[model samples]
Target chain A: LKALNGDRRRWDIAKLIYMNNISPNDCIKRWKGEDVDEDHESEIEEEEEDFFQKRNGTASNEKDAHEGDLETFKPYFETLDRLMQKWKKTDLLKDRFIGKPAFSNEDDA
Target chain B: MAPLVFQGSENFRLRLILATLAGKPIRIENIRSNALDPGLKDYHVSFLRLLEAVTNGSKMEISYTGTTVIYTPGIIIGGSHSHKCPNSKPVGYFVEPLLYLAPFSKKKFSIVFKGITASHNDAGIEAIKWGMMPIMEKFGVRECALHTLKRGSPPNGGGEVHLIVDTLLAQPITIHELERPKIMAIKGVSYSTRVSPSMVNRTIDGARKVLRNIGCEVDITADVWRGENSGNSPGWGITLVSQGQRGWCTFSEVIGDAGEVPEEIGMKAAYSLLEEISNSAVLGRPQLPLAIVFMVIGKEDIGRLRISRAQIDERFIQLLRDIKTVFGIEAFLKDVDDPDSDDFIVTIKGVGFTNTSKKIA
Candidate 1:
């Protein structure tokens, strides 16, 4: 458990921990015995976004081990939501209005 | 009849999953066709063998180059079966996908998955036990159990997991839950194999230190394996699963590395669990794919689900797109009414695909 010069070793070599998900980005500040506040938590959120950044240029989305990335997805998801609402409500309603009515206008009937 | 054709090795598992569930044949081309070691990997081969064992007459044809595959799915005739999982991937890799097929099997699904229990790339057994189970229960799965019979580490893998699902759902219920429930309890598993038992205590202490601030009750169990049950390697790890009142559950775990101390593993898992709890949706990130499947296959009525915006990563998007292609079902995504929360409500209409192979009661 001792590091060089009789100092206590930190997290194995500490390098592997940094390389993995235990980085401060995943909220390790709390584990480090550091004071954590809302501001620090918000900062961690931004770092996490960077951690899950977009890699859309490479490989098919369905490929093994290549789940979708983090950045860019929020915007893409927003656009999709808007388009779905437009098509499901506006276009479908318009298409139905254009087609023959289930019952002709009551007065005409 | 022409079979569904797909390109590349993407969604390899999903394609197989959909094909089996839909009783349709699928042909996949150009799997890792451009890579240096272009072709199906060892895990892929082992997974395919496991699939065949779990079902009846699932035929698979691989080209001499291993870049193309044609799989004719068979009915799930699940029963007692055992397979040796490749060390390249953990048991969770094979078992996660298999659970999707279990509820539709002819008999109660019973399988023994022997391999490295924990790995960097896959969910550990504890996640499936505490986290995945509750999610399945929300969709009307009656009784299922995941037992970690042995602990194994990578390279010299020799772990075993016995999974049993005694009940089947005629059809998964339509779940339209939107509220982000409150977490009431956090249960955890800290384990060691062929290592000093002190490692487990150290891990629990480190985890408890971080979790002490939370208002909920935190209980972490320490598991130790003896003799042959310890598997072939020495390692330690921790998996923390959180439970909310309304069937919302999630898990985070960390496996000890070659030089990593037990305390670090505990702290890592605790921190990750905090990250997961921050996205307090009805399902955890790992549970999203499973929810998608049953939501699409359940009753024809629309099922609405709420998920944090953080969970809207590429894999989730691609899975939705794939469902649109294969099942011809689209999910209606929209912002939740609560402006304070960054959650999206996904509304999907299930296809009402019931298990035809199941025997009549």
Candidate 2:
């Protein structure tokens, strides 16, 4: 996708997945600015931020006594393969690498 | 050939390596041009010096201010050589790029790199040796070995690594593996240098606790180094390798921050390994770029690999652009229609590149 305009700028990807009931392909298209439906586009809830931090293991000040070291496990899956399959099905993964040219060259070359 | 012109200091190593391999001169301008320092970093300069040492007839010129670099490519004349890698970067930093050039050199490549051996910034020494080596072997370049003589931590760093890559390939075998392999076992090494031996065990305990629930046979060795081989700094780290029956390997490493507890490092590493497995990558993230580069310049045939969408990040796209610019080839990408897989099969026809430095006698 080409460069997106100002109005359709950066949407918090993790929030998009957890909050909305959207197809993976459509979510990706929306992320790339191919879809601009305004109905489902809601401001991210502040309380849900803590919930996301718990699931994704972001910087959470407080931790569970026993499971603090471990990442949030999907309680429904009994086997590791089953859990992996669940992850693959949900397709919650994001391309996490930085795409911007490191050390930008904005000046005349 | 016209000199390939690029901007910025990012991907400094790959650009130089590709230029050397293709025997095309390159001119890089506006390197960190608007920054406060506004020039190439010391490690970049050191890498350039390393290129000069291993290759013959290479010419490099830097503008007086050091923002622009003009490099004329040369033939790789491999031999027994040693380089003092600056402590700013780990030996893994130099070793990864060097692997691409080793088999293509005139002679059996042997190089001694001394510097910080283990760090969080890049893949550590063990990851390259245990994790990436098998991937290289699949492409049919054998007889590559790494012997870590000393383990060095960062800051006040003093560590040493010896690398030997002898066997050469007529061409890398065309590879295609689309199915994500099932991991059968997990093995790792938890090593400490100049630190209390008990710390290693604690780390192992933490990792084992998490791995226990995964229902796999896990084996981890605790290596405690004493005196000289431990290097000048006190540090510890762990390297974990998980593999399936299909030769698919994934690696995770964590270096202990100074005065940090070993248990945290172990937990961190275990979590990282789990993340890699669940990421839907057929090949681990770090090795994908290396494989792509090799395939792009390999035998004149289409090579295909199945990888997940999450695997295609920004650096990967940039690499594709660079590859197109340098080799005039594009990767044919098609979405996988499999019900079970969220992946794309990448197809590319090789440029039939051969090692000009290694003339057939």
Q: After superposition, which runs of candidate 1 have C-alpha atoms over 4 Å from their true positions?
A: A1-109
List iRMS (one decimal) for every candidate.
23.3, 21.7
Compose the digit string of candidate 2's lDDT tens values, residues B76-128: 88799998988888888888888888878888889999999887667688888
Residues B232-323 of candidate 1: C-alpha lDDT, one tens digit per residue: 99888898987776767878877788888777678667766765665447767788888989899898899999887667654565567567
List of clashing residue pairs for candidate 2: none
DockQ (Cα-based) for each candidate: 0.02, 0.03
TM-score of chain B only, all predictions?
A: 0.97, 0.97
Task: TM-score each candidate.
Answer: 0.77, 0.79
